[model samples]
Target chain A: MRIARFDDDRMGVVASDDTVVDITDLLEQYDPLDAADLLPDLITHFDELKSELESRSASGGGKSLDDVDLHSPLARPTKIICMIGNYREGTDRPQQIMDIFFKSPEGISGDGDTVILPPHEASIFHHEAEIALVIGKESKDLSRDDAMDAIFGYTVFNDVSARGLGREGINSFLGKSFDTFAGFGPWISTPDEIGELYDQHITVHVDGELRQDYNTSDIERPIDELLAYISSITTLNPGDVICCGTNHQGLGAMQDGDVVVTSVSGIGSFTLNVRDSDARQWQRGVDEEMAARVRAQGQEAPAQGNGG
Target chain B: MRLVLTADDRIGVQTDNGFVDTSSVFDDIRFRTAKDRMPRVLAVFHERRSQLEELAQSGTAEPMPALQAPVPRPPKLIAAFGNYREGMDGDRQKQDLFLESPESVIGPGGTVVLPAHEATIFHHEAELALIVGKRAKDLPADESALDVLAGYSCGIDVSGRGMGRIGPSRIGKSFDTFTPLGPAIVTTDEIADPQKLQVTLTVNGEPRQNYSTDDMEYSVVEILSYVTGFMTLVPGDVLICGTNHQGLGAMQDGDQISMSIEGIGDLQVSVSDPHNRDWQRGIDEEMAARVRNRAGSR
Candidate 1:
C-alpha cells in the first residue's frame, strides 16, 4: 500500500491515480489510535480502510489527492539519522563511510512547501535523491537479511544540507540540522511491492536539467552492509528515517525560488522551494502534560487548559 | 502560564503550579512547525523581537498570560561566563573564568537530583538564557544578528560549588532536575535589551542573590560571537550565560527554589525523592538471587 499524510496533514493512503482517502475515518471506524502507528496495526487495518475507500471511491464521496496539503510522511519520528557522506564519489576513504548524524524531527517539510535558504549559510545545499527506508519494528544487531525485512517501506528525501556546514569539523550536527532543512515525501511505499532497495535509480534536478543521476547499486557498501554497520552502533527504532546519503551530482548552491526535485525509482518524488528563513516560534508541547502536572501540583486547570 | 515540551518518551508543560499535561507535545519546536496557531500563542515574541518588547514598555500591548520557560535539552548547549564583576569573586580570575570550559548543564524541569555522596554542595545559578535559532558558525550581520537567537528563558547552571582545583563533577551537575527550564520560551522580541533585565534567585522563600544583565563582562552578542568561533551553533540549542554570585552552602532535601527574569518570567521547583530501587536493598537482592541460581544449577 502507498501510505501518506495528506488532506490538511491528516492520515490517508493513495490508490490508483484519482483516489486519495483519509485513513483516519477508517481508523475511527475500528479503533481511534490504531491508524496512527503506520506499522503493524496501521498495515493490519488496511483491509478495512481499503474496503471503505473502494466503496467511497465508487460513490466519489472522499477527497482527491489535489484537494489537500501534503506533509512529510511521518508525523514525528523516533529519530532522523542521516549518513554524512555515503556516496561512492563523495570521497575515496573507507573509514569515512557512514558518518552518522542526527536532525531534529522539526526540520521535516513536505511536497510544495518552501525550504528557506539563508544567505549566511555558506556551503552548497544539495538535493539528495536516494532510496531511503522507514523502520517497521524495533531492531538491534539486525542481520543483513533481517535488516532488509525490518524495512517497512521507502520514500524520497532531500537530505537538505549546508555543504560548508561540516567543513569546520568541530560539530557538523548543527550545520546539517537547521529548522526546515529536510524535505521528504509525497508518500511511503510498502516494502513488498518495491524491488531490492539497492537497485533503484535516483535523479536530482534544479530547473529541469539533470544534475545528480545515480543508481542505488553504485553505493559502495550496499544497503544490507550499511545496515549491519549502523545497527552495530545504534538501536533502530520504528519510524527512524535514514537517507543513504547523496551522490556528488546533488551538489551546488540553491537560491530563493529554486524548486528542487528528488525522485527515487518506484517510490515517488519530493519537490520543495527554498525560502529565506523560518525562525522558531513555539509555545512548546505541553497540553496533556500541563493538565496532569497541574493536578499533581494541587492546581486546577481550565477546562480547555491542557495546551498553553 | 503554560510552557509545553515533547521528548523521547514524554511531553510536559509547566504552569503556575508545576509540570502539567505533557503527553501529546511532540518534542518539536512549536512556531517553526506549528504555524496555524502561531499568532494565537505567544510565539509573536519569537517573530517580532525588538518591537514587541518596546511596545510592552510603551503600554501598548495585548494581554498574554506569563509563560513558564522552555529549554528542551537542545541538540547542544554551549555556556559562557564573564561580564559581571561578581564573576571574579570565584577562585579563578573572572578573566580566566569567562571562558570556563563547559563544566555542566541541565534542562528545564529535568532534574539535578543530588546523590547522597559527600560531593561539594550543589546549587542553582539563574542566568539570562540564550537560545540559538539558526546555523551560526563564523557568522556576522546584526540585523541577521538576533535571527540566530531562538528564544530566551531563565535556566539554572546547577553547579557543584565546592569541587574546586579538580575537574567539575559531571555527576553532581548532571542530576536529573539540575538544569530545569520550560515555563515557555521568551522570544527576543519580548525583551528589547536582554542585558538590562533584572535576575533574582531564592531558596525556600529567602532571597539568595540578585543582579542585572547589565553587569555582564561581555554582551550577549559578543559572547555568542566568541563562542561561534570555536563551535557551530544550530537551532534548538542554548547557552546559560554565567549567573550572579551567592554564598555556597549545603543543600538539603525538599529545598524549594524560586527564580525569575524581569519580562521573561519566573520559575519555581522543589527537590524530591529519587525514583530508583533502594541502593543497598537492590544490590543485596541481586547477590542473593545469583547465589541461589548457582546452587540450583549445581
Candidate 2:
C-alpha cells in the first residue's frame, strides 16, 4: 500500500499512479493533538485501520494527484537520522565505522515544494539522491533480524546538501539543515510494494539533465544491519526517518530555478524547485571530477577543502 | 510558573507546594480551538498560556506524577558548541552550534545509556537551555530576542569524545539518552535574568562542571538570533547555550550525574554503559588544560 499526505494535512492512500483515495476520514477517530501528531497517530493506529484503508482504496473516489498539493508523507518525525559514508561511492574503500548524523525535522519539504537555499556563503548546493526508511514502530537496540520488521515503508529522498560550509571543512548541522534541505515524497511505498529493496535504482535529474545514477546494491551497509546499528545508538520512534546515505557520484550544484527530481524505483519520485536568491552559479551537470576523486582518494578526501 | 509533564504525558504546573495538573484545560470549551484540543504540552503552551499562568497562580496542588521531560518531544534540540570561555580571563571564540537528535532526550531521573560504540570517553556538558515560546525566525541580537523564550531548563549535553575524530562531532553527541533536560521549565517571567545564572554539573556527588552564564562568548539572545537566522524555532524547541569546558570530565558506568541551573530546578540522571567501559574519574585535567590553552590563544 502507498501512503500519502496531501492538501491541508489530509491523509490518503494512493490507489493508483494518478489517484489518491481519501482516508482522512478514517483518521478522525484518532483525533490528533496537532498537525504534527497526525501522521504518528495514523502509524500508531495503522494495524486497526489497515483494513478500512484497503477497502477505501478499492472503492477509489478521491482527487486526482495533479489536483492536490502533496505534503511530506510523515508530518513531523522527531528526528531525521542520516547515515554518513554508508556508500562506497563506486570506490574500493574498506567499510569504515557506521556513523550517523541528523538533519532538522523542520528541514523537510514535500513533493513539488520549493527548496529555499539559505543565504549563507556556501560554496555550492548539491543534491544527494537516496531512499528513506520510515520506521514502523517504536524501536531500540534492534537486532539485525528484527530490523526488517521495524520498517514500514520507503520514500524517495533528495538529501539536499550545502557543500563546503562546515567549520574547518567538517560537517555541521547548519550546513545540511536549511529549510527544505531534506526533500522526500510523492508518497511512501510499503516493503511488499517496493520489491527487491537491495537492487533498486536511485537516479537524480536536474532541470532536464540526468546526473546521479546508482543502485542500492552498491550501499556498503545493507538495510537490516544499518537499522540495527542506528537503533543501538538512538530509539527509532514510529515515523522517524533514517535517510540511507546517497551516492555522491552524480552530486553537483543546484542553483536558482533548477528543478531536481530524485527517483527511487518502486517508491516514485519527488520534484523540488531550487531557489537561491543569491543567484550563485556553478558548472552544470554531473560533478565527475569530484566523484572520481571520491572513488580514488575516498569520501573524506574531497570533503577536506572548501568547495567553489 | 514552572511547567512539567507527567509520565503519562499530562501537562501540569509545578509550584512551590506541588504539581497542579493543567492537562484538563483543553477539555474546557472556551480554551478549545477549532483545530486542536488535544492534551499535549505544545498544544497547551501554544493555545492556553494565560490559562496555564492562572492555574500556576491559584489552582489546587496535588502530588507530582511520575516525572518525564518537561518538553517530552521537542521539534528540535539545538545546541551551541564551544560557545563559552574557559574562565573569566579566557579569550572569546567564534560561536558554533549543532543539532542533536531530539530522540536522545530523557527526563529527570532518567538514565544515560552509553552506546556500545568504542569511544575515548563520554563527557557531560551542563549548560543553560532555553525553551522557545513561539515560532520565530530571523530574530535580532537584542533584548527583544528574549521575547520568544517561554522558559529555561537544565540541560546535560552528554558528549562522546574521540568518536568523530575524523568527521563531525554530531555522531558522538547524538546517542540515545545523550540530552537530559528537565525537572521543570521555569517560565521566563519567573527568572530575573538569564545571563547571570549559575550552571553546574556533578557526577557521583562530585563537582565536575561549575560556571556562570556571564562568561558565554555569545549570550542567549545572540545564540537564538543566530540560530533563527537559518532555521525556524517552534514552541517547546530547546536551544541549549554552550557549556564551560573548565571542569569537564568523563561519565561512566554506575555514575550518578546531577545538573542544575539557577532559577530552574535540578535534573539528576544515572549513567550506565553495557560495555562497562572505564575512564579516569573526576575532572579530565588534560582535556581541561587543552580547553584553557585554546581559551587563551583563540
Candidate 3:
C-alpha cells in the first residue's frame, strides 16, 4: 500500500494523488510503543496495520508529498547484506557459488539525500543499481519454498562504491562502507504491488545518461535461493535489508554535483546527489600519499576505471 | 565498574559480591531529570560516564545468573584483517579491515555450532574487543582515539578455514554463533594498558592460541583511528582487534573452548554439530569443486 516514513519520523501512506495520509495518530492508538518505530513493527503486524491503513486512507486529512521531506522507509537496518559477483558478466569466475559481503548501517542515506564522496587516496566513484528486499519476519534456516513469504516488500537501492579503494581486491567492505554509500527508497512497495518480481526492469541514470539497465531475470541466482543461502548462515531480523546483486552492464562512474537515480519498474525510484566530503580535510596527509601513489603510476592510475 | 546483559535481556552490573540489577538505574530521577536518555549500556557510558560509575559503585548486589553477550546486536561489528604478526596470509603490513555479521555473535556459555558443510574446517582465534562509547567520525587530531572507548571485553573469533581459504573471510568467518563475546565488559578505567594484556584460548583444556596484545601490529588506538576515517563508530559498536596467529589450530565438536584475557574474565563456549541438520544449500558439489580446484592449483 506504499507505506512511508517521512517529515520528522511520521508514518503515513501515499494516496493516488501523491498526498500522504498521516497514520501516526491512528497507529499510536493500536500500540504506542510499536508506533514510535513503524517500519520494523510493520513487519510483525503487516496484516493488522494494512487493514488499519486502508481504513484510514478512506477518510481524509492528509498533506501533499511535496510539503515534507522523505526519509528512508527503514532507517538503520540491523544489517545490509550485499551479494558480490552474483551477476554472470564482467568476470571469468564460475557463477555456481554466491559470494556475499556487508555494508555498515551508517552508510545508509535516504531519498534525495546528498551522497558524500569521502576523499580517499584515489577518486573513482560508481553507482550500482540493485533491487533490494526488506525482511518481514525473523527468519532462520529458510528453505527455498518459504523464502518468498519472509520478504515484506521491495525497494530500490543504489550501492554507491569507491572503485579505486576496491582495487586492492582484499575485500569490498571498506571500499563500500563509507558514510552515505548506500541509498534507498522513496518508499517500500509491497510484494503484491510488484507482481512477478523476476521480470521487473531495473535501470540507473547519471546526469540524465543511462548507466545501468537490466532485468531482474538477468540475476545469476534467483531471490529465493539468495535468501535461503543467507539465512542459513545468520538469522534475518525484521527490517534487515538484502540487496540483490547488480549486473555489470552499462556501469559508469559519477562525480561531485552529479545526480544519480535508481529505479525498479513497478516498485519506485530514488535520486541522490554526489558531493565531495568536508571530512577530507582531516585526512589530508593520507589523501596526499594516495595522490602521490596514483601520480607515480602515471596515466595508468587505477582511478581511471569504471566498475569493480 | 563492569556491566553485563543477562540472558533474559536485563541490564546488570558486576559488584564485589555478586551482580546488581542496575536496569532500574535507567528509571532513576537523577537520570530522568538530567535528560540523560540512553537505551543500552554503552550509550549510558557514553552520555553519562561518571554518573553511571557512581551508580554502579553504590548500587545493591545480588546473586549472578547466566550471562549473554554484553553488547548483543550492536549496530556494527568491525574487525581488523591482517593486523597481527605471524600466521597471516598475503601482505602482513597493510591495515585491512572487514565486517562481521552482528547476527553471528553469541554470549558466554553459548555453543558455536559447526555447520554441516563438507568443506568446513573450523578454527579458533582469541582476541581483545573494544566497546565504543561515543559517536566518532573522522577523528580530529586533538582527540585521543582511545577516548572513544567505553570498555573492553574478550571475543573468540571462530573462523572456518575452508571458504576463507577460497575467498574473503566474510562468509567463512560469519556463521551463526561464530563470535562469542563477554563474561562481562570491564570498564576502561580498570585496564591500565590494553596492548600489554596476556590473551589465551584453550580447547578441551589444551592451549591452542596464546599471545600478547603487545604483539599486535596495529594498536587499538591506531585501529580505531583508521576505522573512523571512513566509517562512524557509535555507542554499542564493537571493534575486534585482529588475533595473533602464534598457535592457531583446528577445533572439533564436543570441545569446550575457553578464551581468557588477563584483565577481562574468561568466556567459556562449547562446539557442536548443526543440530539435526542434513544438507546445506550453498555448500554443494559446485562449491566443493571450486575449493578443490583452488587447493589443487595451490
Q: Work out the TM-score per prediction.
A: 0.50, 0.90, 0.85
Fnat per model, in the order shown: 0.00, 0.36, 0.33
Better of 1 and 2 by DockQ: 2
Q: What is the C-alpha lDDT profile of model 3 across B196-232, one tens digit per residue?
A: 8999988778776778887777788888877888888
> Residues A65-130, candidate 2, lDDT per residue (tens digit)?
889899989877767888875788767777756667778778578898999988888778889888
Model 3 ranges off by over 4 Å: A30-36, A56-61, A90-94, A166-169, A277-308, B28-39, B87-92, B140-143, B164-166, B275-298
Better structure of 1 and 3 per DockQ: 3
TM-scores of chain A, one for each prediction: 0.76, 0.94, 0.83
Q: Could you arrange the candidates by TM-score from highest to lowest?
A: 2, 3, 1
Question: Judged by DockQ, which candidate is best?
Answer: 2
Relative to the true structure, candidate 2 reaches a TM of 0.90
Candidate 2's C-alpha runs over 4 A off are: A55-62, A297-308, B6-10, B26-50, B61-66, B87-92, B164-168, B295-298
Residues B1-298, candidate 1, lDDT per residue (tens digit)?
A: 2234333322233333444443322223233222112222332334543443333344322233333234443544444432354534333222211111111233334444664434434556677777666767655524456677766788776654322111222223433345666455666766788779898877777766578888776667766765554345655566777754532223446667777889877766665534331222111233223322322110
lDDT of 1: 0.54
lDDT of 1 at B12: 34
lDDT of 1 by residue, A11-126 (tens): 76666654566666555544433223443345445545556645654444346777867777876554566664565553343333234555545546788888766544444554
